[model samples]
Target: MSSDDNAAHMKETKEGLHSDHHVDILHAEVLASSDLMNDAFDGENHEHSQGLWQSVKSHPWACLWAFIMCFTIVMESFDMFLNGNFVALPAFQRRYGVETADGKWEIETKWQSSLFQAGQCGAFVGVFLAGPVTNRLGYRWTTILALVMMNATIFISFFANSLTLLVIGQAFEGVPWGFFIANAPAYASEIVPLALRGACTATLQMSWSIGSIIVAAATYGYNKRDDEWSWRVPLALQWIFPTPLMILIFIAPESPWWLLRRGKKAQALRSIERLGSNSNAEGTQQTLAMMERTVEIEKKLGGEPSLLDLFKGVDRRRTIITCLMYASQNFAGNLIANQATYFFEQAGMTSEFAFQLNLINSCLQFVANALSWPLTAWFGRRTIYLWGTATNITLLMILGICASIPQTNSTNYAQACLGVIISFVFAGTLGPISYTIIAETSSVRLRALSTGVGRAAYYVAEIPMIYLASWMLNPTGGNIAGKCGYVWGGTAVVCFVSAYFFLPELKHRSYREADILFNRKVPARKFKSTVIDVRENE
Candidate 1:
């Protein structure tokens, strides 16, 4: 048969797989593709090759949307770091005790640490509750709920008389925190077209760096203040930052994917039109066909797959690898570098030197992430993961050894600075790339459930991290640096093995294609070859 006939036959055969449950998959892809056509795919790219930088820079609205949605993610990062590090900032300053030179509250007390943990505890509950809520109520409501709750957390934090009250407020904040983190990227992914998805999603990471810098700046600015009010202002502003976002997103387009999943075809079409600029009708039609097929498949499969289903079949491997990947990423030790500036002081550096070290680390992460942008485009996903995981392992070992050394007041700050730089290098490549892997490799039938599970692992992973570090950092123990390094080094080893054995390259595969890959019945260790290797016949 001729190629045209072969193409038609393949299409026909694929169409047959669009049974009931398969419809959800088909619709989501179509909606995603349509959203991309309007928001991401460029028909013009077919005719002319555009330089990568030029292509990205020219897409202002896409960039703007990315920046906007990522702002909340960024705020969350800022809060996470600020909350994490606030414990280390001198309790006199962390609590509302001291006043600033300008007569503002500087910070005070050990209770603030608990208040910070309170936020995470709230986050745990919020994260758990967000899934069903989003499923029932939609991403918009979740976003709104989080924004309101975050604002309340900040405002209540200002008035919190005791740690108990602060925890209560953080609990409220955590609810939305969980909601926003869970749904924001999914919502953001739906808004952009496919070609731009990688770039846009990767850019969300930039927000974390931005948040780190902002919190650092805020903390630094308030450092001179002798009062409790200094840090509170910045913490309060976290909620304020998202009020506008909540308003804007509520008025913005709902996920066409979500609409299609809920069997709202007309609404889905209308949602796509609103997302596009009227030049996207052809793209819209293509997207609609893709979504319609996806919806049909889901319907045939008898509706949404249960959480248990995510653990069955090839999806089981995908689920396991995904968990490992996310777990590795979180455990890689950047959180310590990112938040524990005060620990540097305990590590033999002065407070000024410690802050400077953190400054260098954050800057390097920005630079590293920027460098990786083009590299990610030229390289495939699996290659990046392998290289990044390996590189990170090496850097982490170097950090572990450096941290194990005894530093004096006269120790070389420059060497310490080098450790900070390597930390960023690890984060720049490993940090963002791991998220990409987790998001890409999972089966669509289990994406949301898997994502939530991965995120929960992330938060839960913190318990051991905090416990070990706290024990090691005890003034009498002097093992903080050593223990921190050991934990990360171990994680690196796991990552290297996981990548070698289990990870499948997801480059260029559609969501449906991924499903086909999982169903191929290849052993987990051989996944990459059977599905993605695609070497010519021997």
Candidate 2:
């Protein structure tokens, strides 16, 4: 607040409690002892200007809680990883697929599409369910309920003798995964100081990469077996994540942001206290002031935090940008990249070699994700995402050109090399950074609903795209082979154009500052240079 505003707020506080002389005396004492404008009043402001490591060191407890919540993403990751990679397992194909004229067994492209899409569709429902449920029940209890729902649903897919049962089970299990996707990052973002927000939120993506890394190794180990256990072992592993996460969440602090939204100021304060409680009293109050002011402004601007508010007023731009930011992941070729193991096998590498290459790619993804924490801090979200997408275009163009020529060992190896590079760039840059962008873009009042709606858009885009990917990659389908890179390259161009126009640089901004920038309708290119009074709520 400006000097005038601060004086007015203090005046109003004193006048309201004027009849209570004791209150007035205590308020004066606080004013004399604590300066709201100084570093003591708000540690976040102090940390905001500090470097990344300083921020991390300041909020170690926040980081620990954030990690616990982010770890929930690992459950969703394992399910998704198994959903696609299982098709690449030779024994899995022998167990579930048909023998063709060439005497080779293969799972049909339609089934592959159906299995993954079932999970997508289920996640759509789960995200929608989570938004409202989370608002009422809070992030902690809602996660507990989702755990129960997920474990129960796993049984349906685990023992199924028919593909239909497995598909239904995958869809059912997806509902809980949707809940995890929508809330984990939001919870992480709320608990941390602003300096840690971007990297912490982006860690949701790292947990995902961690999940992929674990399952990749497991699938490679089991891929060589020609028995039912080859696939069943990985499916059984799904149970590992949720049970442990449920136990940890029982003792975790509720998101202060979520509590403040519910108008439980005391509880919000206590939750902040619980989350290592901000270092000092002045810092705690300052944190609450910033969080409270930001939430109140959003509520005023957006009104009552309904799902419809996501598309109204300034929120319209935010909601659309967030949703498309998510959809761009699929557009930039995630669905195609997701089937890399199958892509390699169809392109003529042995199944064992394909798994080996996939394992290497998964490991590289972890390294990229680890670097993204600092890179996100240094380069900013919009810059890195654009760089990642632009690089993918060049790589995909070359891959498409290579695919156009007659098949050769050299061309196959070239396509494999290009595919690994695309995933690596995505993991480090766009993939994880997108998590940061989504959290930053959504208005705090409408954050949970916005995340759900945006993630739901991701699931929706994947539906048709999954079918196209299956047809293009499957031998019995379109057989577009490595030339599929052209399709994703074309879409990456769309991602670049949309990002250039729509995505803004939200780096190093507090939630209040971000809201002010969007409210002013600043141009995307001008975001970094824009200045505001910030003292006035308007």
Q: Highest lDDT: which candidate?
A: 2
- For residue 232, model 2's alpha carbon misses the true position, in angstroms, by 0.8
lDDT of 2 by residue, 1-538 (tens): 6788867875564344323232212212232323432322354455467778887777788898898888888887887778778888888788889887889888998898988899889999999998999999999999889998989999998897878889999999999989998998788888887778888988887887888887889999999887888888889888887788889999998998888777665566667766763466545656655666666666656545678888788889999998998899987756655787888887778888988888888888889889999897789889999998999888888889989999899988988888888888888888888989998888788888998999999988888999898898887898888898899999999999999988999988778788889999999889989975445455
Q: How many residue pairs clash (N, CA or C atoms closer than 3 angstroms) in each of the candidate models, in the order given?
A: 48, 0
**Model 1: per-residue Cα lDDT over 1-538, one tens digit each:** 7768755754553344332223223344433333323322233222124444553544445445555765677766777767645554554344634554655342333343454555566666776676667767776777777787777667776686765776676666666666666665556555555444555566656777777777777776665566666557767767557778887777776676677777665566666666655435455545555545544444454457566766776667777876777667655666566545755655667665666666666666777767766666676666777787677667667656666577554343533654576567665677666666676666543455666666666667664554555455434334365335666767777777877777777654545445556666555445445544211111
Give each model's whole-structure lDDT.
Answer: 0.60, 0.81
- At residue 356, what lDDT does model 1 achieve? 64
TM-score, per-candidate, Cα-based: 0.80, 0.92
Which consecutive 10 residues in model 2 have the weakest lDDT in total?
22-31
The root-mean-square deviation over C-alpha atoms between each candidate and the true structure, in angstroms, is 7.2, 4.6
Error of 1 at 420 (Å): 2.0
